[model samples]
Target: MLLKLNPEHLLLIRTHAASTYPEECCGIILGYLANESKTVVEVIPTENAWSGETLEDNKRRRYAIAPEIMLKIQKEARDRSLHIIGIYHSHPDNPAIPSESDRIQAWQEYSYIIVSVPNGKAGELKSWHLDGDRQFQEEEIEIA
Candidate 1:
């Protein structure tokens, strides 16, 4: 599978990641899915809702979006005739790859976009899709 996003949408995600440097930034992706491609129609920047009590649960290494936000986005997207095709987040000072925690938290059929933020700057951007076997497979990202 692959994900298609416009330059503007990409930029928005990158900027949001950079702005939230040292912590994970997360959001929702609204788009249409056809065959093997998910074409992005909108990017919604959201707050990192995960508040872990321990250092291991810090936002710098983890992120979560509120369930209420998810419901709200779903309703808005449905009204606009779009679907929630994926979720996006930043990996501050880490590779743009899905970690074990990511895989455990992911839902099949949803694309996951990870942006690498290094030194408060957005570096590489990559997309992933969890397969039936519960493994993350790299997804092609088409920016057009």
Candidate 2:
């Protein structure tokens, strides 16, 4: 599948990644699916709501959208005739690859975008989708 996004949307995600360096940045992508492509219409950045017991388990390695925030976004998307086509997140100082935890929590219908931020600089961006076996398959990213 293909993931299409405007350059402005790309910039917004990159900027958010850089701003939240050392901690992963996360957001929702609102859009529509047509044929075999997903076209992004809105990019909504959110706080990494992950809270762990120790400082070691922090945003640096994890991220989450609060249930309330997700519900609100879902309602807004429905009103605007858009679906949550995908989700995007940053991997600080790491490659743009999904971790095991990512797979465990992902839904089959949404594309997953990961941006690599090495030393506060946003680098490669990649898209993925879960296969029937629940394994991640890389998707093509088209910037317009």
lDDT of each: 0.96, 0.95
Clashing pairs in 2: none
- Estimate, for each residue in 34-68, the C-alpha lDDT of model 2 and write its tens digit: 99999999999999999976776789988899999
- Model 2, runs deviating above 4 Å: none
- Highest-scoring model, lDDT: 1
Tens-place lDDT digits, model 1, residues 69-105: 9999999999999999999999999999999999999
Instruction: List candidate 1 segments past 4 Å from native.
Output: none
Could you tell me every candidate's TM-score relative to the true structure? Answer: 0.98, 0.97
Provide backbone clash counts, one per model.
0, 0
Q: Could you tell me the lDDT of residue 143 within candidate 2?
A: 87
Per-candidate Cα RMSD to the true structure, in Å, reads 0.6, 0.9
